[model samples]
Target: MIVIDPASAVPPFEQLRRQLIDDVSTGTLAPGTRLPTVRRLAEDLGLAPGTVARAYRELESAGIIETRGRNGTFVAPQGDAALREAQRAAASFVDQVRTLRIDPEQALALVHAALRSAPTAP
Candidate 1:
């Protein structure tokens, strides 16, 4: 299940992407587990199908998930190292934000603003 924050600064796709990654890393979504179809997830999250598709595409690019034609998407095999590294980086960011006494909501807003200003990579 994914939550969409229309008021939050983060894009829906990024939110979905981050949550999926976090879930996989935390074992809330185990490896080899099948993921909901993009359309289904988008509908459930009240997001555009393209938004969910983009998140799925990025996750696949990160090697966190895989898709096999009609077989559907699944958590990739061999992503433990990648997931661990990502978790470490995320934890460090959280620690830094906490150390700076940044309000959680404000930090999330900043993330959304920064992401909006960031240039897209080729």
Candidate 2:
């Protein structure tokens, strides 16, 4: 399931994409889990079909999802190398915080605050 906010600074497609990525990374959505059809998901989320389609395309290109014609989209199996790459990409964000002169404690506190403020899973 996905939610969209018309008032969000981020675009609807990016929100959808990031949510899917988070789900996949956290294993809430396991590999090979089928995604709803674009139209259905778009309607459900009150977004344009094109928005969902664009998100799906980007996910597929990033090796996060795959489409099998009529079989629809499913989460891709993230191999060891892909997992390593994702981890490295995530680490770079921390490096950026360091470059900005943020202390480790402050950085960790910011992360904790964000985690605390995030919506709880259903």
Candidate 3:
């Protein structure tokens, strides 16, 4: 379940996006699982439709989900070569971290730091 903390420093849309990404990556949300419509999710989370739409758009752009016109959005199948390679790299990283006995929180922090320092695409 996606929880939005009004008190959180992070924006609601980012919270939703991160939660959905984690769910998809961890297999908590299986491939082909249908996601709630933007309107419905916004209502359920007490957020604006535009916020949910923005999250959805970002996820779709990242190849994490797909929208079927009139049919609704579902988890994207793991067919993209780039996505598959990324998943493999992530799994390998996790294994290496585990072998080093690194705490998950610290590992995630390292990832966040790296992402922040990385250059953006043009």
CA lDDT of 71 in candidate 2? 86
Among residues 3 or more apart in sequence or in different chains, the pairs in candidate 2 whose N, CA or C atoms overlap within 3 Å are: none
What Cα-based lDDT does every candidate model obtain?
0.84, 0.83, 0.86
User: Per-residue alpha-carbon lDDT of model 3 for 88-118, expressed as tens digits?
Assistant: 7699899999999999999999999999998
lDDT value for model 3? 0.86
**Lowest-sum lDDT 10-residue window in model 1:** 81-90
In the order shown, the candidates' Cα RMSDs to the true structure are 9.9, 5.3, 9.9
Q: Model 3, residue 107: what's the lDDT? A: 98
Q: If scored against the real structure, what TM-score would every candidate get? A: 0.67, 0.66, 0.67
Clash count list over all predictions: 0, 0, 0
Q: Which 10 consecutive residues of model 2 have the lowest summed lDDT?
A: 78-87
Off by over 4 Å in 1: 81-122
Q: What is the lDDT of residue 71 in candidate 3?
A: 95
Estimate candidate 1's alpha-carbon lDDT, on a 0 to 1 scale: 0.84
TM-score of 3: 0.67
Off by over 4 Å in 2: 80-122
Q: How far out, in Å, is residue 36 in model 2? A: 0.1
